[model samples]
Target: MNGQMELVSARTVKGPDPVPDLAAVDRLVISNSGGKDSIAAMDEAVNLADEAGVRDRIVVLHIDLGRTPGGQSVEWPGTADLARRQAAYYGLPFEVRRLGKWPSLFHRIRARGQFPHLMTRFCTSEKRAAAHRFITEQVNALGVSGRPARIVHVMGFRAQESRARARRPALEVDHRASSGRRTVTQWYPVLRWSEAEVWQRIRDRGLPYHWAYDAGMSRLSCSLCVLASVPDLTCAAGLRPELAREYADLEEEMGVPFRRELSMAEVIRRAGDGA
Candidate 1:
């Protein structure tokens, strides 16, 4: 909406990163994660819906992991609220799904005192992935949606965030989530954009987003969530000391180790310095 002002070097799956062209997809759903990448995808998804002459079909999917104890988890300033506002702005149906509040054995242990490592992402599976899968299955089985939906599952994943993410293709099927259902297609429009591009797009669009960044939060996942890096954990510890203590306690209780020395104290020390 910034008068279509060109980004310095905005790149999409297609060269030139044209906005109107992406609108050609039939069923375009912006997978809102309250993160800048997903927010950018929301903008593009709306743009695409308009161009494809299916503006009414546009929707936003906000999946809540449901167990964290933060404003961004199940509270007022949570991820779902951020998503709702964005969806309303786009005039699309915002489908907010909660993965539930009950914890499994592993989550209980991690939340109690055990630290989850790079190899283990139980929270994501129990929460994020579960909600996403259920929705897809429900929609695919609907009676009126002929031939299932040739949906473009627009996500906001940036390659520069990590080594593994760096390897993801700008355009590819989400094989990790796909169940051989050709009707469901995944598209990473913001794959090539840097972290700067992600924030720039959010600011330029004047879209509603989370304010966790103001509290020294980098990515808007769970507060003591395991995907955090050393600096991330450290920052969380400083901002939310109790959560840090809980994470440390959890790790000590579990007996398993984290790759980054498996010690939460290291994270706390590295917090402010961005280590």
Candidate 2:
């Protein structure tokens, strides 16, 4: 990630500027998660590309987190559906990718006999590795076709999301680089966008977002992410009691709780207590 990192102020760029060298870009892959931020990022990316007369080069990629036990998805229902619909709405090509069999987060937790920690996040690492692998494969395919690929990998991270994210640069060279003839660059078009601005952009585009947000979910990465807040976990349990039970059952079987201080059973109990 080499470059003179610039922390663009949110107040300065309500909307992102177009890429300076659109003609030199081979592909502009937008990572879509079917979330508000992702939708807004894609909208901005499309606008930028369209203004530069390179809209055809835009592509959207969605990573599907496999199902949990009892054949239930770990991700929010209709996430992929909305992503595909959004892609079609914008007339951009879309692709969905997933890890191989036994890719379920629950399966990993059971196998490891431990849940992911906030500090040691294996779940996020695994998912990120898979996404990077897919991106690398795409770059390689372009190289095989004798095309010099210069990829602009776009994400939906916003500075207002968190302090850690607020420190992120607007642009930088990604650590993962394709060999000769392939260059990888990272772009956070919505890095300076506020939460309200993100939603405003989605509403302005009249795009249908994932239903999870309406159901009170602040983030849509995982149905029961370790980083989820008390309210988020409670909401998830209410929506999917069986999946929540699976967590408690696993915790009992392994004699290890999902959280260090609280067991899944206790967490659910507290949620029921409305505390």
Candidate 3:
């Protein structure tokens, strides 16, 4: 909303990044994780919605991962607060949803006796399902007059991040959530953006982003993610020793490594060594 905004442009499937039809949708639900990419995506979505005259339909949502056994955060400290601040910056309605049956993600993982991995990422699945349920509730509450509610679930997933992410389409109809009363679509507004572009956009907008990035974290997810590289894990362990210990202790109890290559204990050791 500040300083020479280079608003995101619409695209075709054969040409470039796909942009959702903001005006056609009754609701634009932005899934912000307090990461830089999500922040940039939110900015892009807002700009496009404003251009489409549907700025009032925008709503920012954050899925809180909950905390650990020792009362420490499972995710980066202040992640939810940062997300709320970002939403407030745009003057958008914000909502936070947590797991219904479980206290936190860690609790669920513990009950299953396994940590989520690349191939079987139940963590992502659970979060996605939770978001869908919340959106469905909203759709039901909107009470569309004669037509199905049109909603777009916006997320921040850049193609440059991973091969799986790169293979994802920028816009797609979410048939799983769609029904006779509601038509749901998923939109990644910043899918084609590079890492530099994301940072540049954040700087241009003068937006408030997560503090973890300033503390040497390249990405923000759980405080310690199994998919993270060793260096990133080490950095996180260095920053949140107690949280690292909880994960390490969980690994010991389950007799399964946090990651196939190494353990959280090893990451903690490396973090200590570097310190």
Which candidate has the highest lDDT of all? 3
* Higher-scoring candidate on lDDT, 1 or 3: 3
Q: Rank the candidates by lDDT, best first.
A: 3, 2, 1
Q: How well is each residue in 3-118 modelled by candidate 2, as lDDT tens digits?
A: 21221222323555334355567778888988888888888878878877989878899888877768778787778888999899999989988754457777877887899987
TM-score head-to-head 1 vs 2, winner: 2
Give the lDDT of residue 67 in candidate 3. Answer: 83
Model 1 spans > 4 angstroms off: 1-26, 68-77, 100-115, 137-141, 144-148, 175-182, 257-260, 269-275
User: Among these predicted structures, which one has the highest TM-score?
Assistant: 3
Q: How do the residues 1-275 of candidate 3 rate in per-residue lDDT, one tens digit apiece?
A: 21001122364532576676666778889999999989998998898788889989988999998987789888899999999999999999999999878789999889989899999899998898889888987887788877678888999998988998899988877778888787787888788888998999989989999888888989998889888877789999999999999989999999998988888899999999994
Candidate 3 Cα misplacement greater than 4 A, ranges: 1-15
Computed on alpha carbons, the lDDT of every model, listed in order, comes to 0.60, 0.76, 0.85
Task: Judge candidate 3 against the unseen true structure and give its global Cα lDDT, from 0 to 1.
Answer: 0.85
Q: In candidate 2, where is summed lDDT lowest over 10 consecutive residues?
A: 1-10
Candidate 1, pairs of clashing residues: 23-48, 113-249, 113-250, 113-251, 114-250, 114-251, 115-251
